[model samples]
Target: TYAETKFIEAEAEFLVANSGSFQATGANAAAYEAYLEGIRANMDKLGVSQADRDAYLSDPNVAVGTANLTMELIMKEKYKALFLNPETFNDLRRYNFDDTIFRGLELPEDHNSVLNGQWIQRAVYPSSEFSRNEDQVRQAEKAIDQPMWFYN
Candidate 1:
């Protein structure tokens, strides 16, 4: 979706600035624009009324300018916009489930004990895969709580 693309653009621009390849001012400006566009695109997709969209976007909390923009805010918006998406799970893993980036996120009270109070890193392979290709599946097997290489 266009909204997802805009969110990705916002993240890329913000990360580029942090990586020192671009000036913070210019990169943040681009990121901020992309962030707002992402929200607008998602709202449009959902058929939100124009007046409601305008009111939400113009709210003080949502309209925080470039200088106040942070990776947390970008990710939070992306999380909200992509609710229940597989990409959200992938993103949570990418960020190692850091609460700072995903405000209000909390571990389930009865989460798997294998996690030892940490977030689950990834889903286990389906049982059918292990049954069909035991050798390959065993080779790739990891603890349920172990972090994947994709983590930052």
Candidate 2:
């Protein structure tokens, strides 16, 4: 939970720090540091080795404040650190699944239903809900592929 807070704070700091170029600046290094701190916190929780953590942080791709550091890099780290956590989808949605921001993330070759050639922005309410609260549920566009209320 603290990591989540830190990550959010990092994002805020990043937004303020890089208001134009959207690149890391020396003055913006605090957000960059906070971002790395988030990853370190997750590593600490997962019992990752100090050596491995050092190695990971050393890699140019994973290093903070380098040219390689961008919104995608931050989100990708968050994705890895929060794997299987529901908040993962929140991150995806907040960024609108922009391929530029989530590089290397490809939709499945054999697409699943309800998400044909598109991001499954939101799932339709459960079928049971449709029956139990047809009027209320029907108000929500009635499409499984529809984006959620906030997305609209």
Measured against the true structure, the TM-scores of the candidates, in listed sequence, are: 0.89, 0.77
Model 1 is weakest, by summed lDDT over 10 consecutive residues, at 19-28
Clashing pairs in 1: none
User: What Cα-based lDDT does every candidate model obtain?
Assistant: 0.83, 0.71
Give the poorly placed runs of model 1, Cα more than 4 Å off. Answer: 20-27, 150-152
Provide the global lDDT of candidate 1 against the true structure.
0.83
- Candidate 2 per-residue lDDT, tens place, 1-152, comes to 66776677677777676773334443267678878888888888888999998888787767755334577667777787778998888777766677776887788887776566887776557789877988987776556556554531
Q: CA lDDT of 86 in candidate 1?
A: 93
Distance (Å) between predicted and true CA of 20, model 2? 8.3
